[model samples]
Target: MEPKPATPLLNKETPIIQSKPNKKDFLNHLEAYLAKRDGVDKLLKISRYAAKIVLTSSALPETLTLTHRLMSFESSVGVSRKAFRLGKFVQDVNALRSSHFDSTEDVFLSIVAYGGEGVYFFVEQFVWLVKSGLIDKKHARRLGLMSAWAEFVGYLGSVSLKMRDLNRIKEEEKRVKMSIEVAITRGIKCEEEKERLGKLIEKKLMKRFSVVQDLADALMAVADIRDGKGHFLGPLSVSIAGLLSALISTHKNWVSC
Candidate 1:
């Protein structure tokens, strides 16, 4: 009995091994799970809505042209072919979203600043000005406004056609409408501030163009134009440019911090 007890493996240590999952296998499982939850479709739908809102709010000619192209392409193709094209379109829009996010360095800011009605109007006008050969793109691009606007247009124009997406557009419009008013109010305060802004606009921006009153009137018009449903792009553009320029000029020193 003592000899049998001595044979017991008392010194033996058992190692606990953990199972390691391969990254590719994990991804495959995750994708399968997402497919089961309809997450991919939902995400794509949301993307479509986001893209539509950005495009509609910005109202850039290039974006509009792209939208028309997509529409024409859809109308011209068969159902199966259209689905393929739409997938490609979504990919292109997502790429644009990535580029825009890269430029802003923040998704929230990119969506808000570029997607908001105020900035949209500004970019739309700027693009128009650029297209008409009225304003130089160099300064605007150097200011980083052009890049933001470009991404906004590109992403928005890539949106697919869906009924729910249209409803989302309306919701987005409301959000943009409220945001613009709030931002403008916050940006420019009392009469002194307004007057100061006006003077600066006249000095810096107006000096370059013959359409001083158009610009000034547009700047003032944003205060009264409350609805996103209305045709306020012309005026909204001036307001945004003024606000953005003032903000940049005032806060440019923050970069050193």
Candidate 2:
């Protein structure tokens, strides 16, 4: 038609070349990952419990020497991770100072959770010092017991708070669903509202995973509080719980990173 624009001189289409990640990109990503304190701590935690699991498993051969090495590695990692928490309790205090709650129950639970955690972390420094051989080992058991109890209380408060928040989220989700149904029934165009509600629901669902992590940590705390002498919780059970907690924490940290 109409002389076809005088014929193109050359092909105008350009080839698309996909760039792959190189060694420099990988090193940059690894550096970013290790830069976050929580990310590194969670990785170490995962490694520690994974080692414990392998050490306790019967399927491994020459486990005596392996177990000893694993135990040493695990212990060292545990102590090192505590060093990351030197001023961690200040975060809890700051949170408490900055937050405003809707009810007295929320305030009480927040205090219990954050306060208990603060105490636990504060006590943990001494325990860490003991483990590091700066303090006498004789105080280790008492300090450790206190830390475990505080951690258990913190977890209890955390679980309660999360349950309350979950209930509220569920109620909100129900309201949103009903609204969506009504809107659809009335032939209303609310695509933006529906999308917002969907994202809210997704966020709430992701938050529910934290409860599982908390429960697993609570189990480990119970084991620590009892010095691993509980009937239902043996070395294997504790190791499994620790691993579960570590994996959940690692997932959270990785996603945030």
What is the clash count for each candidate, in the order shown?
0, 0
lDDT of 2 by residue, 167-204 (tens): 98888867766666566556676665566566666657
User: TM-scores of all models?
Assistant: 0.19, 0.84
What count of clashes does model 2 give? 0
Compare the candidates by lDDT and give the number of the best one.
Answer: 2
Among all windows of ten consecutive residues in candidate 2, which has the lowest summed lDDT?
Answer: 9-18
Q: Per-residue lDDT of 55-156 in model 1, one digit per residue for the tens? A: 445565664578776444433331222132222334334433665333333454434433542344344454444544577866544323543444344333
Candidate 1 displacement at residue 32 in angstroms? 1.8
Each candidate: RMSD: 26.7, 11.2
Clashing pairs in 1: none
